[model samples]
Target: MHGQTTFLNWNKERIALERIKSLDPIAHGYMDTPYYVAYSGGKDSDVLRILFELSGVKYDLVHNHTTVDAPETVHYVRSIPGVIISKPEITMWDLIVKKRMPPTRIVRYCCTELKERGGQDRFVATGVRWAESVGRKAKRNSLEIISPRMKDKIVLNADNDESRRMFETCSLQGKRVLNPIIDWTDDDVWEFLRYYGCRSNPLYGCGFKRIGCIGCPMAQDHERLRVFGRYPQYRAIYIHAFNRMLAARRADGLPTDWQTEQQVFDWWVHSTRRRREVEDQIRLSEVAI
Candidate 1:
């Protein structure tokens, strides 16, 4: 088993290096203009940054602070050398109030506002690997372009099949994205990290699988519960956001099953799937002032 794993690691390394070589034209062109590394202070990002260094590529590391991230993640990113912190214009609470509902897996406006900010015009490299999720496996590529305008268009006309296709394939000439580790497995990421002796985010030491936004809709129940247990502050913030969302919903005449703060919080974490199972339409609209 050890021998087979070693062979697989070597093969993955070769493929990743080849992908990096293929990205040379884009990387080299952005050399003087400061290419960006979308660092998340996770194991995957750690490996991605180290790979850039190992490959003799120069890039700037940027962490987009979601304002709902675990305190430990913020502390870790701040401690890293040359990490430029990019903060969202609005906080998670502000976003929830604006959207009139908590961000579910399907309606992840928080991702657009926070995690996906600040890489609009320049070339950005990310630690997006196919092994991470089913959606990423299908949608992500080794090289692609992500235009905010295109994404917004898709979000507006989300039901249009052609618009979705266009959004998936849309790219501007010269403004681009590079996901050099798109094909890497989770084991491959850890192997690379171990090989390079890189220090990971402290959350992993506490048995967290990934370091992401605190109470992120994308996280599993166990992950969210762990974070909420360790940081009551986040739970309090979430409860506060839920109260605000419920109030906005009430004012807007929206009908919802979420009656109390606990119910809303529980529904956000546990009932979204059940809710979606019986509905084909969005129950709540964005609250208008």
Candidate 2:
């Protein structure tokens, strides 16, 4: 099956390159307009970088630092040639305190603030694969233009009617978002990486299925555990943040059932399993503070 999938993927790769070549005018106004890649320093992103080079398209690369990423991943991204490393205004720890609650899968404000802040007014390419998630599969188009105003509103967290109208009337052209390998699968990503001998993040070799923020609630319990166990310093930072959040809640006359930092950390990493229990505890201490 792997061999067959690889064979099919090679053909698909050729077709995808042709498709991107044909979109030069629509994506960048001309063949010479350089596009940008939102490189993640992961397997898929490495493949995307190579794909852009192979496609003979003029492009640059950008990697937004989430701050919560593994040290090895950050090092790897920094080591990449000519990659622009963009950092968020606030660190993940500070964002956690400002949010007043841990980021859950449903409310991933971090992505908007950290990950998707790139490609503001320029043509940007990404390594988004339809196979990665159902949401991306349904929502992402292979090639689409993002209004510069809308992009600004998203990154700036401004979502008012006036802002919308202002953006709608803005004279600046919208940015183009290109997903060159949107149709590729996991097997295809690894195959391409091996073929090119690309050096990906070292965290993958340490048994992480994906490389992103450590202790991210969206991760599975096993993955999260491995991350916490592997990186004690980050785990300590997360626990301290949780401790501070709980203290603030207590000071505000809210539920403070999870008293210790350890308790808060335990509940946080395993909260999904006991969602009702955690929610009920929070509800029990509700007050107009």
Off by over 4 Å in 1: 1-11, 14-18, 25-32, 148-175, 272-289
lDDT of candidate 1 over 46-114, digit per residue (tens)? 877777776665577899999988888889999988889998899999899889988988788889888
lDDT, each prediction: 0.73, 0.74
**RMSD to the native, candidate 1?**
8.4
**lDDT tens digits, residues 10-119, model 2?**
77678567645655543544433567788988888887887777788667788999988788988898898889999899988778777777788898988888777867
Which residue runs of candidate 2 sit more than 4 Å off their true CA positions? 1-8, 25-33, 146-175, 250-257, 276-289
Against the true structure, candidate 1 has what lDDT?
0.73
- Candidate 2 residue 271 Cα shift, in angstroms, is 1.4
